[model samples]
Target: MRRKKGLSIFQKLFIAFLGVGLITLTISGVVRYRAKKGFIERTIKSQLTDSRERSINYFNRTFTIPIKKDLGFIEQSSSLNNFLTSQRDEALLTKPPAERLFLHFTKMPESIYLSSRFIDSKGREKIITVGKKRVRDYATIDHFPNNVLYRRIYSLFERLKEENVGSILFEGPFRYKNNKHTFVIGISKMEPEIGGFGGAIIFLCDLTGYLNYLSDIKFNQIPIAFVFRPDNHVMLSPEKEASPGPDLYQSQEENINDALFVSSSIKLGSNNNVLLNLALIIPRKIFSSELKNALIDSVLIGVCLIIFVGFVAFFISMRLFAKPIEELSRGTGRIGRGDLDYRIKIETHDEIAQLADEFNRMTESLQKTTVSRDMLIQEVNERKRTEEALKESEEKYRTQFEEALDAIFIADAEKGIIVDCNHAASELVGRAKSELVGKHQQILHPPEEIEGEFSRTYKQHLKEKEGQALEAHIITKNGEIRDVSIKANIFEFKGKKFLQGVFRDFTEQKRSEEEKKKLEAQLQRAQKMEVVGTLAGGVAHDLNNILAGLVSYP
Candidate 1:
């Protein structure tokens, strides 16, 4: 089977350390991003709220509140009232009403007015009007020349009359007599007690220059500033292109997508029909853009940290573990290939050092044991060689004895017992070699002739000076008799006298001699018959001549 491929320990460890570092950095980045996002959101919201509130307060302070205060001062001023009331019976000033009012006030309005119907108790109608330097003709002929301003004041006047309000304050886009558009807050006060029956005073303060000044000053990046009437009519704004105003009665304040919007109605007016709305349209992208930059910066820092951590981890691991482990691996490979002398050289005083010490000791022990075992094996091999030489000699003798043609037996001469026999001897006796041993020598002869033939042969062998040869009839293990030629010798082995006999089987030779005698007898009988036939033939010829003579006499 093929082994599966996989990452090595070094790669796995490196990956584990890198993954941990990267994950930690990524988590930190995420947390930081969330925190920054939240902070930016709150900051943006707070800024928008504060900007909206400040703008509203500034608009009221600069336009609405001052106009109303001026109108109230005019209403409570005893000098202005007495001067205006005396206009019913006498001329309070030789100059026109416009110059006269400007003289009586400490801080004069841009335009001041007495109503057209302000006919004092006398038959003269007193139109006391004063106009700013820019709008000198604002009170000309006791009428507003700008139709837009005329309509706005007329509307507020009608509403104040309907509500029975003494004074009405309103804010709108008013065109000056100079034909220039300006935002203004106006307060029309109807004091029935002062001036006469048709007595009224109108104070108009031009806020267009102030609003334009504010429009040039921006918060961060020029936030959108606009002024709308209560009916959402665009009175003042910085947009070059005019805005498509909302419904005339639209009163809801809402944010548009990513822009934050807030509107504040001027509260200084008793005129419900008119409202001064100051709106700040702050784009939300400012906050998001800042947040995005912060997030990018945080991520960059996190990446740098992760990279630094990875490098540190790599350096530490290489120094502390990798080099030592690599040395151990190489040592293991060398040892596995039978290099018992190889040793791991770890320099650190840690567990690896201990392991190297143990390994070196084991290698030393193995080397020593290997040398000792080699010496012992050499000694054992010498002993084995000697044993093998003896075995070879024994095997040669056994092969000759088993291969002999004649049956050979060794019998103890003193005991008259068979001691050992070859395979041929066992065959001649019709018994196995194992069965022939330890048996009396009489077993080789017939049962009737055993004591006589075997005893004589043994006695002859014992008495003769040399070994003896004899013909003998032996009985096999099955009781069949066979004639064998036997030669016997007396030998002394290990200080004991033993009889050795070599026997040749003669059963086939005796059969052949009997067959030859019968064939010779048959040949003699055939020769005698041949001789008698020759004599009979000659005598018969003579007898035939005599018998011929006797037959002629008949």
Candidate 2:
């Protein structure tokens, strides 16, 4: 297998930062998505619940009126009932009995109340009204008796008795001709004027129009309103599929296929015992729209966040990792090309910075220790020129030093040992330069002056820096004592302290001064003798002249 390529520092940094950004964004997105989804669900449930409550309240308002309430209008009219039973042919509702039934039935609404007919104990019509204009007594109903329409009514009544009945019975939904539906509402009554005959007032209702009206009720036209049986048959609906489905009738509230079905009982008649359910069908998209919108927004926001963090990571990788490493690489290249002075300028406070510092130090060592042949030669020549200059300067000063009349000695200030002496100092000490050097400064002086005059002068030179000479005596190499005046001072050279003293020899001069004093004393004595002899000669000459005269007289 070939060698696998490894990721570079920049690649590693890019991957690390980008991966971290993605992970963090993923976590945040998940949390935000969950929160948004939950909020949307809650809002949908709240809206659906509110809509269900409002629908119940609305249906309650519309169906509150009972259809069975005739206010005892037909039941209390005994004369009208007896006349309706006695009449065979009712003429245009002109008979008092027919006119009373017509006017009474007219009070019922035409939409739900199609017609009202009163039956005697034999179940025959005494008075009947269809709509506002048509009226028929018991004779007229026998001719038109129970058409496909009335047969459907009687058939519906059969279905009504099976239900839980109250003071009034509400039933229906018998399929009429032209695909219409019919319902019947009735109550048993006793007419005392007609031999206490047991009878009933049955109303034929146009249920299709009323059911359509109820179905048409909607909230902003979104949900469909309808009535359904326990068997899932749609009694009335805006869509009118006839059979909605088997699942809808499971409960008062249900969710099927992502849609919500909320139902409330539509109670009718005086007893309000008719159990019809008004179902409000809410589709899937209406309530799910909140969750859908939240999903879209969360995806968009998550994408944006990931992109922004990735961009930031790109720059961070470059600044923190790539740039420094590139500089170090360039520095290495420079060093390879013999530019040892080149250094990486890395500003990062990390291991990369430490590497740069170590690189610079290695480069510095190379600069000091490693060089090309021509560079070595140039350095050597430069050093030779410096050495020649120093030697020439030392020779110029040494000539003046050696030709000096006074003897000079240099000693270590800390060691009190003589380090160097000029030629004159060697001669004054009566010893060679090698013998005098490396010895103590006190060794040049007499034994008595080692701790006395010489010691004071040496310590005073260190204390006062520079001062006048002190008279001192030294023993020469030949065993002669020499008198000298020593002047010493402290000075620093090459990071060390040194003491230098100049010795002036005055023994021969002192002897010449003593010989001149002895010569002057002898000359003074001879001159005094000459002066006395001259004065005696002058007195003798006078006395001889006088003695010659006195001897002649004596």
Candidate 3:
């Protein structure tokens, strides 16, 4: 026969430690990567949501609030109305409302107004003024009576007469005369004297400043602002020209860049009448780099950790196990190779050294043991008989413990902790023997008795050598209560005293006694009824005899 070689314990242990280390490293790496990646994604989404809210407030404040303020001032100004209606002669006042409006229009530089004008109900220009530039070089024109655009302009003026006071009308980022991105807003003017619709005060708004500010609104150094109509018409964008780009409502990849987009619907002014979509766009690449770096670092650290663990396992196994086991094997080989006086020796004071000492002692005692082998066998036989008798006694005790009708419990005398219980005890408690053992004596009593009656009785039982049969009730695992007569006796085992208890369930006997008392009471009542009936019969007989005597005398 040949020996089959297998992996040594040292080799198996090293591989096991290495495998566990690698698996742990991989799991931790994956968890860390996911946590960092999720954090980055949440941060991006949060920024986009915040941008949407800010855009709503921005449109309302920058564009809506200003137009509202202008209309409010105009509504309160009587001087402007008097000048437009031409109610009085110029001799009435030197400073006229026409001159006041022109001065206010010139000061509209900061407001970015290209031109401000007043038109009558009949499509006639009442007053007009330009800002920053002389002459009419602006994209929008007030006087275009005979041109192709005249009918369109006149139609707008007629519509202005139908619109109510404080209503605002707007037109384009359209290119007409100049290649300028401009818009015209018309506020309906009212005739307060008749309270009728009168005319319109229109302003040509230059949006170049707004577009530049829109360009400057950057996220992570990328221009994010976009202006578009509800119909997806591009108004102003970071593009060099108005070009149809990717849909900003959904996320997608493009040759230009992949981006995060958020859209918010807002009116250009205070009136909810006209809606526009304002969006912010940020490049996805800006956030990707940091997340990638975090994952790479984790993988690298995990690989290094696996390598370190493998080296530590190898070092420990060689130093602690390999050398001691090899020396023990060699020393045992010398004893087996026919040297009776040889003794195994190992310097290390570990289990391997103890094994060597055991081998040496066996070799030294071998001759003496062989000479007395028959005597040793006879002694062993006697010891076996003693053990068999002890086992038979234990068998008898176990039989009585299990077969008894009364539940029996063995508990430590001092602590009252139940150490052993019979099958009958389990049946009485409606539980398993395993469940009853290791429980306190108080467990057999009701909850109300604990810490009061049970505590006092347990203390009293500790002092007594034997207990008198006491009437009690025990609650079962099924929440049923049964009357029992219980008694305990203290017995000594190895100088420590323990309590052995016996319990007899007598709930049915108590019920029978109560029934007997009730039956005696019923018998007494029946006897009293019989005596009463006899007395009544005798009284009737006496009355009959007296009546007979009276009748005979007559």
Candidate 4:
């Protein structure tokens, strides 16, 4: 199986750093979001409570005193006794007159008043006049007296009379005789001694202005405020009427259970009509909206920042690590493809630099090894060629030796025994090469005589350290004796001493020599006869010449 390439130090380190950074970013972002959310929630809650308290204080300060002074004037007036007894001055005894008298008596800057009369002893009532006589009285009970408002007010008065208290609590609707619209009302009865009136002073209010004021006020801009009221009426906020003018006779019940209710029977005014005080409250929804906005903004900012930072970090980390790693990867590829000379060149002094150095060293060693291996291979090939030439030469020499006519024998120098003999040698010895191989030289001939000669020859060779030639006789395979001429040489080959001999089969040659010697003797005898004849002839010729010379001189 093919092995996978290993990763460089840079690659491994970059991966590790990236993983750690991502984990850290994730953990930090979550922590920041949670911390910011919690802080915003806490801040909103604190501010909302503070704002509610300040609003309530401002509301009480703005309306409470004037309302109390008006009620006080009414309690001190004895004019109500004449008006009730005559009943003819109803138009003069109502609000504008009453309001003007009270305003003058109390020395207040602003005052509002309304008057209602029960013309019949039944439940029907009419609003006589509202503040400044600017509002006209309703014609019938249908115009002013309503079930929810009139019934509740009448019950409150009855209760007040029975208990002999200055005021009674009531919750009901009140109609504006002029605008023909109605609002919820709350009335507090003024004492006869304080106002000289046996009637209730009505407070006209609604949840709209209270809730709106709570929403508008900022806590830090003013003092904090809150309200305590009945809970049931908080959920019963009435729809606002379209009419623009204030309803003097309007009555709004202050439920004791509402968060806006300040007191069940607390004196709102300095006089008899001051039983209910309206305390402002900051709406919980406003605080919740602020908290939500803060939380959302913090989360959005955190997410955007974290993403931006992470992206930058990732790119920076890659630039630091990935570029070097890619360089190393390319270097590795070159090396793997048998480019042992390839090297990584990096200037850093970190672990990657160390790795590059190690790689360079390894490649250097590999180059050296390659050179050495090539040299070794060439040496082996040369040796193999030389061995082949030597083998061929040996085969040629062996073939010539076997086919030669001369008898040749190789003997062991130390043992004086035949080591190897050619075919002719075996024939001359009258034995097979196998039989002659281990035999002593003396065994080839007559034992006593040849042994003595062989001993002399061997001793002579040992002494002179040279070749020796001698005539010898050998017995053939047919039991025939053959004469031979032997030449022996002592040689050393391959660290072993050996004796080599070549013998000519001189049996026929010796006979021819004998015949030639006999022919020479016969030729000598014939040549002597011819020489005697020639000397006789020369003596006869000299005698004949002397006789001839004597005859011619006489």
* Residue 162 accuracy (lDDT) in model 4: 41
lDDT per model vs. reference: 0.65, 0.68, 0.71, 0.55
For this target, which candidate reaches the highest TM-score against the unseen true structure?
Answer: 3
177-267: candidate 1 lDDT, tens digit per residue: 6654454333334454642233345444455565675575455767467766655667666664845356422433565666655555655
TM-score of 4: 0.31
lDDT for position 46 in model 3: 77
Q: 1 or 4, which is superior by lDDT?
A: 1
lDDT, candidate 3, 474-509, per-residue tens: 889988988888787889999888988898999999
C-alpha root-mean-square deviation, each candidate: 63.4, 59.0, 31.0, 68.6
lDDT for 507 in candidate 4 is 94
Candidate 3: 10-residue stretch with minimal lDDT: 132-141
Give the lDDT ranking, best first.
3, 2, 1, 4
For residues 1-554, what per-residue lDDT tens digits would candidate 4 score against the true structure? Answer: 99888975555655676676567556865676577656754565555445545655655664455444444444445554343344455656553454455334223224332433322223233233344343344333345455555555556445444443344233432334443222322233443344432455444433344445554554435322222232212211222231111221122322222112122222342233332333333234434566567666766775676567666756655666666667777887898889986888877666667787888888898878978899899999999999999999999988888888999988788777988889988877678898888888766665433543365455555557457677767776676777777778888989989988888898998989999999998999899989988998999999889989988995
Candidate 4: list runs displaced more than 4 Å.
1-27, 62-65, 78-99, 102-128, 134-148, 173-199, 203-554
Q: How does model 3 score by TM-score?
A: 0.44
Which segments of model 1 are wrong by more than 4 Å? Answer: 1-24, 28-34, 87-89, 92-99, 102-125, 132-146, 163-165, 178-198, 217-220, 236-255, 271-274, 284-290, 306-554
